[model samples]
Target: AAGTLIVGGGQAGFQVAASLREAGYADPVVLIGDEPGLPYQRPPLSKAYLAGKTDAEGLNLRPASYLAEHRIAHRPGTRAARIDRDARRLILADGESLPYDHLVLATGARNRDLPVPGADLAGVRQLRGLADADRLREAIGAAERVVVVGAGFIGLEFAAVAAAHGLAVTVIEAAARPMARAVSAETGAFFRAAHEGWGVRFAFSAGVTAIEGTDGRATGVRLAEGDVLPADLILVGIGVVPNAELAAEAGLAVADGVRVDAFLATEDPAISALGDCARFPSAFATGLGRDDTVRIESVQNAIDQGRCLAARLAGRPAPYGAVPWFWSDQGRHKLQIAGLAGPDDASVLRGSGDAFSVFRFRGGILRAVESVNRAADHMVARRLLAAGTPLTPEQAADPGLDLKALAT
Candidate 1:
């Protein structure tokens, strides 16, 4: 009999399989992935892997032997054509069917493609999967100048790597500041200043009209005003879109992603969704007077949600509730965020300069914390948020008190 079937062999899918075995669920667990390889971590693709600091073996969450030893059957480079909910089977692209008792959709996401003239040029690259990263690493080696479209985390990380290599890096952002969607204005300004100090150029409030090229190879980027920024390479890092088409075709609820409840379960009992593809009402948000749901895209969320789902399937039923956190490494700076912070959340500054934290408050209650080069503050903030500990803006802004001590 089938035990558990997980679609999409990314971090979430791998974690779910691993967690199931750890929880003593001894049934057939089949992980089907469209990618060709053992499940690997995607985080390093734009950073360490791109920078040549780490190799492909290091990006792997588990070695191939571990998967085989654990009896977690993984179908690498195999795509799931559709979900047969009524028959409780997953239809493969090759016309094979795999029956399952429980299904976990960790379809994840794909990088948003740039729609403009000459976007399909030879040197125009996007960093998403291992293949993309591999191509980009090779491209960067011969590139004299790099132009990045978008100022999001991925864009900045790639820009940092390029800038460090002494390449002329120019980042174009349609928004007023970097990371406008994720961080507050204060935090955005701080990062902008930091990136500028690193010899990276920024063109904020600028829209890309087209990509200029010769012989079908990217050579430069053309702005909305008809001015072209010369470049030998172009990396588009403009966020991502959930791979929710399969779920939607199967008639599952889908908005920005597959909509699930607090338990990460869909309306149908047999199927569930996790990671970047699942949009669920957050307990953390609700506690802070936010009635809506949020779809988080991060390694931490995927791992935590996978473990939560695994436990429930192992006959230890519990609602999925965990404080969300994320981190980004841009050059020497490590920016970490604990809990979810909305755009309109009131932000209070704690500390100053290179090492600092931004306490985000919603309705006078601390909702999230964004820290730059402050690992201790990030850890403490996570604990406090997880335990529902009260922390006022006044207390957070004061440098005299110890944030970590209060967490305990």
Candidate 2:
């Protein structure tokens, strides 16, 4: 008998299963994953994994012995076909069903498809899961020139890795700046320069029209502006679409993702959602004058949400109010951001030189801090934001005042 049924074996699902055992709610926690391997972290897929600095063994979040020792049933290469909400059971792909007292949906998200004319070419790839990363890694090594569509974090990160390996890398983006949706323009410009300094070319404000291929192999990418960029390999990194079809089919309220309450519970009390697949009421303001739904795609968000949902299932219901944080690794720059800043916010620079911090202010209140190659400042920003301590722009800009001390 399965005590808890977790759908999707990514980071969020694995964390919840581990947390349930840690919280002493052990009966039989079973994790069903569609992928054919152990649960692994996705962040390293674009960075160290592609750089060959770490192998598959290093990517596993937990060893097989740990799961076995905890008596957690790990089911890989298994897909959850559907959910019978009334019966509280999950129908598997192999014509089997598992009943659960509590269910956790960590279905995560999949890479959005590039609907261009030549998207189906053999050399075109999208990096999202572990398998995708493995294929891209192989392609990157054999290809001389790589054209990346969309200048988001994943695209830029992969470009940096390819450029570091002396491969000709060109990043095409529809927007004027990279990561315009997530970071401030200052931070975006900083990364653009950093990647450019490392020999990565940028095609800003360029939209890809199609991927030109010969004999089923991608030859180059055709832009909307009628320019053909020659490439032996192409990677699509537009964004990701949440895997919320399961929740929607089960009649749960679905907007951008599986809709959840403050406690990470869906409309159905017995079911919960977390990680990228979940869009819950955010604790931070989205500049829309009210709390809106947010679907964060970061390791920190997944881990924190997993822990919070597990605590709720353990009968210690707590509102998920974690300070949203994110990080991106491009070349030698370790860009870290604490708190979410809106487009209307004002940015202030604190330090000068290779290492500096950018403080985001909205209506005289400190909203976020973006640190570049400054680990210490990033740590302090996380602590200060978590404590809800107020820091004005003047105080934050003071060069002599230590951020860690002020945060305390």
Candidate 3:
């Protein structure tokens, strides 16, 4: 029963534990989490959960009884103080040591705090966990005006919800467009216009100097240009920082995150990392003549990495290479991206308006597809990318062509 010790009871951690059991690994499986409840899906925290469409119980990734049935020793409300590589022990905050033959780090990431004056005000909040969502839901119900600090997915999604609640909403982004770092310029413009159509105001290329407070609560936000926008509540969704200090302290190679090889294994043979915390060289990138590693913060990356690592640990060693995909729900639009797209990649638009898709090509080969409300195109892109099928921009832009047929 001396086997896998998984730190961080998140999607990746829970998947690894379940995958091990599914692979018939009859050993001790311990999953530790700093949160007080069962692992839950995080995407809903900003979307459905914040809108009161779903409750905390609905956010649970799996039923509470599932852990008991799988024989996974899930320690909730616990934190790992440090990892001893030589001793193969995980030291807990309460002074308990857990021995393991293999260790997996799914530590994930934390919400980056807004470091500015009045940031500690009562009405200012950041959404990352269940508790954060609960507090935000209560705040949104009573808020008259909501000011969002970033125009990323979380910010836009929450802004849509706030707007739906009949509250005045304004989103301030330091970047020139919404989701500038993640999506292409065309896709960013589409979402920006879509959000605007839904009664949301945007302040692009705008910097926040400070938050204005009154009676220990946020009253508004001060722009870099000395203009103050009034708001009753403020939400910060700038970005996230990987929780890789635990692995770095144990001498694991860490850059933007814990650097891993193609197999998702760290420098230590017995230790591996996955999910948002692992930065590994992507096979997809290597095919495109880039050897640099990437740290993806999507559920697809986490679940795929977990299953890949599980199979390898269970005597089915294979390099981890899965076509990454992501989706975000904002108001009436459902934006989906299949495969990875670099900043320099050329984009070709197909269709138009809300039902169109943007195909990204690097050196005449399709790299990624960003589809807005086009689920069929997204599904086709996933198959095409996974098969490594060469797609030309001309073929993608042609309305008469069948993308799904070409993929097969």
Candidate 4:
């Protein structure tokens, strides 16, 4: 088979194949994925799916017939062993091989393992894909005390779900505050207060030393301070490591991820990478006074990058320059972020109570906005950032100011 070969049938890979067909590119597109079943949306895996609000079928991006109709050759439950860059070939783990005119290494990222004792015990889980969510859903049903390691979006989202079940949920974080690396201190304080109000406990500046197991089942988590948090189920959401080993082993430059340019193209013109696996230059990063390259792990980034790459492959080239955005649904409240921001960015407050937006500025330039239960502000923020619209700190702080009008 020739045409484009997409290695990883996640959102990014599927988008590329779909977009190529939509763009009327007459080529035999093949998408090989390691996960069994139709390609599905992952964001819901930690929220609605885990909370029993949605099922596996609801998670799919499209129906099975859509792939066939689009002429996308879906190869599920297949693994790519390595790439023969010299020959433009992809070797499968099962000793099969396929050649491609263009290759997309959208292999995505994998959950970083908790390197501690008794981590592999039963009842200890981590949510990344459907299987993990299913196991966790079962484990959560019979668990009373639930301890979540890592205070990132995944952990907090899981905590919200567990706490909703009336379970005693405690979140342990190495950082001084939850989501410390992403949001401003003020925003973190707001969420911390909200979580505490939900009867959810938090252990800040903490580390997990080991997982305590009894009868080959996780019973608790031992902290570094020699304190054990008794639990029937433990969920580890520390972070993820980019699955760029396949690209690296095949002689592609990989730092934290597969190195790509603003066009989302690797050094070799024949190959490209995107999603969580490719670290490409981002305009938002430069505007936020940070490094140019950023590898985002949101559904927005994957879809945008896939569409951008598809345009390029369709003979209409344009640099990938979409504004970065993300969201987290914690119980009744929602947190939305638009654009990239650093720790040192200035924070300005707007709105009151649970409905507010934290505007981040760097060098007097609006960089990012963190909206809590303020969808209107989040929507306007994406436009403001994408268009590089001028918004002053004073203006952002003014509650009476019409942000929607300004953005328009």
Candidate 5:
């Protein structure tokens, strides 16, 4: 009997499987992955991998021997079609059914496609999986000019890589600023300047109306302003839609993602969700007495949720209380964020020179921290937030009181 069945073979699924083994859960564990390779890190795809600093082998999370030695059954290139809740079985594409005592839906997400006239052109691409990255790397190496369709994290990241390689890169964003939804305007401006310093061009408030191509090969992108920008390659880094279709089809409630409680358990107690696909309550905030849905798409979130879920599944039922953190490597600067900040939150700048930290405040209460090229600050923020330490804006503004010192 399949003791536990994981429906995604990315970070979360692999992490939970490992955590279960570490916690002394000997029941059979099976990981099902739609992707055709060993689980790997997605963050490097936009940075190290794109820049040729790392290869596929370097990005793997686990080796084949490790999985085998752990007695974990890994099913690669196998898709879980549906979940039969009544029978406690998972339907596979190959007409096979696997019985599970506990189920984890870590289906992750897929890139949102560019809906335009020439979106189907040969050169148009989206980077969500390994296959997408492989195609992007090959296209970038051969292209003279590339048009990026978005100013989000993925778009800017790919732009940085392209610019570092001395390729002519144009980034088009419908929004006014970069990472407008995720970071403060100050941080966005800082990143914009950093990318600009690397010779990346931006077209803010511009939308791609169509992708112009010839003979099914992309040649240019038409903007909303009736302007056509010529390009040999087009990379669409718009955003990603959660792969919650499976859960929805299985009659599980899916809002932005598979909705889970504070314990990371779905409405069905036997089923749990994590990673980019699970919309669980913010444990850090909720434990501090704030109730809100906090679905995050970061490596840190994936790992923490996976570990927490595993601990609970192993009969230890610990409330999922993890501070959300994220990082992005753009050019020489590393943008790190600790905690979740809302759009209306006020931002205060701390530190100076090339390294700085932006403290986000909501009603005089420290909500989050965004640091660029300041690893120490990011670490401190994580610790303080996880420890439920109170931080005021006045304290954050004081340069003498470093984040690390305050945390101590």
Candidate 6:
């Protein structure tokens, strides 16, 4: 009650509690999570975990014994109902209240539901938690024809796994291309070709109107264009809606997400938010007629923000300014993105063949770099962007120029 009370036991929450202890903070750290198990990795749930390549134990951020040894109280399967900011307390759904010297809102985002008829069918599934992954894995085994409603990272990843299993996989996307909002056109086209080579089908600029079902189980997905795609299972990976209702109810600044300053601190000094739920100012933000604050949903952002907030809580205050980076493993190729790119950003190509990097520039300034199977370029891009080193489009286009040397 006298220490930190962390709500939402995701990666960010786990990191904050772990970092607080690592920083030698002798405060009583109690983490409250609605989930029924210890905090585990979420990214793998759509990839290796669903493929049965990794067990649930392998996904654990740490064993229960580690938490006990660290003296961090972890309350699993408990939901936080309200934030009593006036009393500096977090009210739980069970009518229990937790008082805290410092409050952390790490309530991560939830999977966006498919708003269509028959979406609640038994064969329709979403991958978010361990339980969801467990069900998906079992479903994939029995499913012959799989239809993914979105071509986002999670959907693509699941499609790759299904394709590998020799299942008929079709990815339907409302956008013109896969990952339209995230990656550049060149990168998206490359991945499109790659996924196609793996026997995966894609329906671009298509929307699901309804899921056709029989016997309370999904039979296929009907598109807006009056076409029905047959499927034994439907996987919806549209996106996520941030869990900012609690913060909003508590009278905290909330827009697309819980608004926080660069330090990840809300208007109230005692309250802070991070992970996928908090939108804070980013130096890497494109800010080209868009919100300067970004709510990134990657492991990098979660861990970095957690450490940043943890340091501030431990008396070493520094603004959260880590270079944003993200990755997705689809089939044999790996896509790694460094920095943040604007939609209208100009792209420059470097390297060739199946492996290359797309350097995106906004207003003649390097904003982001997307690397495909080129880990070297990704590392250099992050270093260059983080140090604010000026990388000209000409230098990026030049094959002879050594980015590693320049970064060094």
In order, how many clashes per candidate?
0, 0, 0, 0, 0, 0
Report every candidate's CA lDDT. Answer: 0.91, 0.89, 0.91, 0.92, 0.89, 0.93
Q: Residue-wise lDDT of candidate 4 within 131-175, one digit each (tens)?
A: 999988987888999999999999999999999988999999999
User: Residue by residue across 1-408, what tens digits does model 3's lDDT show?
Assistant: 479999999999999999999998888899999999999999998888888888889988898799999999999999999999999999999999999999999999999999899999999999988999999999998999999999999999999999999999999999999998778899999888888888899999999999998889999999999999999899999999999999999999998789999999998999999999999998556444345578999999999999999998898889988999999999989999998887678899988877989999877888889999999999999999999987788888788998878977
Clashing pairs in 3: none
TM-score of 1: 0.97
Report how far off residue 304 is in candidate 3 (Å): 0.6
Say which candidate scores most in TM-score.
6
TM-scores vs. true structure, each candidate = 0.97, 0.97, 0.97, 0.98, 0.97, 0.98
Cα lDDT of model 1 by residue, 1-408, tens digit? 788999999999999999999999999999999999989999899889999999998988999899998999999999999999999999999999999999999999998889898999998889889999999898888999999999999999999999988899999999999998888898899888888888899999999999999999989999998899999999999989999988898999999899898788999899999999999888667543345788899999999999999999899878888999999999889999999887889999987889989999988999889999999989999999999999998888787988778889
Measured by lDDT, the strongest candidate is: 6
Q: How accurate is candidate 1 locally (lDDT)?
A: 0.91
Model 5: residue 163 alpha-carbon error in angstroms: 0.9
Off by over 4 Å in 1: 286-291
Name every residue pair that clashes in candidate 2: none
The per-residue C-alpha lDDT of model 5 at residue 243 equals: 91
What TM-score, to 2 decimals, does candidate 6 have?
A: 0.98
